[model samples]
Target: MSADLLLSKLEGVRRTGPGRWVARCSAHPDKNPSLNVREVEDGRVLVKCFAECDVESILSAVGLGWDAIMPPRAIDHHVKRERRPFNAHDVLVALETELTIASLAMLDIGKGKMPSDAERERLLLASRRIRSAIELAVDND
Candidate 1:
């Protein structure tokens, strides 16, 4: 569902800013508007209740399921494209690329060849990136 349709279904919706609106919270007895509703650039509706109401409860009160807040393309099969999930193989490929570049640079260094300033900077960046990737992989596990 579009943000306009959702806002229309809500009670006491008034524009607070461009693409932003305030509405009465349906999850509880609210005299003043407590719900902040906005449409992001990607066409997804964002709803937040200032009363600290849970999203599920707020959506239930307004008779909308989770799908209502998702991007339209995500709901339409014709528009939705399959996305690959990031896995160990993807991480390994990135690490391999970094390692290959570092290894070649090291080989040149071993042959008594001095690296240019740009090459040295690239080597440092590759090292830092590999360390970061390792940390990410460990944290993921």
Candidate 2:
């Protein structure tokens, strides 16, 4: 059921690199490994047969269905949708914290003091957080 176990069932499977593998295609007679298998970061398996074998045929040869490589659906379409209330309390709190840091940095600048490396890093982070908050607010609208 797992990607590793499914790949092990194939012939001539070799590790090409991290999360990458070369294997012989079972759909047709082959001497060299022409199938490329990769496990993506999001836990989805990708299979490609350089010999031009179709996905359905390749999967059938190895006793697997399309579901083996497809990501599971988060929500069933058959279920009715529920309306959830929008909550911005956490976003507001984060914005407040970032603003406080930025204001402090501005005060230091007004006093003719250069920020230390750590303070500069904090200021950069606060700037990014403020931008993200603005984007989130726009998206909600």
Q: Per-model C-alpha lDDT, please?
A: 0.83, 0.81
- By lDDT, who's the top model here? 1
Report the C-alpha lDDT of model 1 over 9-100, residue by residue, as the tens digit. Answer: 78999999999999998798989999999888777788999999987898888788878788657567544444434587887898888889
| lDDT value, residue 82 of candidate 2 | 41
For model 2, the superposed segments whose C-alpha errors exceed 4 Å read: 74-141
In candidate 2, position 83 carries an lDDT of 37
In candidate 1, where is summed lDDT lowest over 10 consecutive residues?
77-86
lDDT by residue (66-116, candidate 2, tens digit) is 777765642232243343344679877987898898898889999999899
Give the TM-score comparing model 1 with the true structure, all chains together.
Answer: 0.51
Quickly count the clashes in candidate 2.
0
Scanning candidate 2 in windows of ten residues, the lowest lDDT window is 74-83
Give Cα distance to truth, residue 77, candidate 2, Å: 10
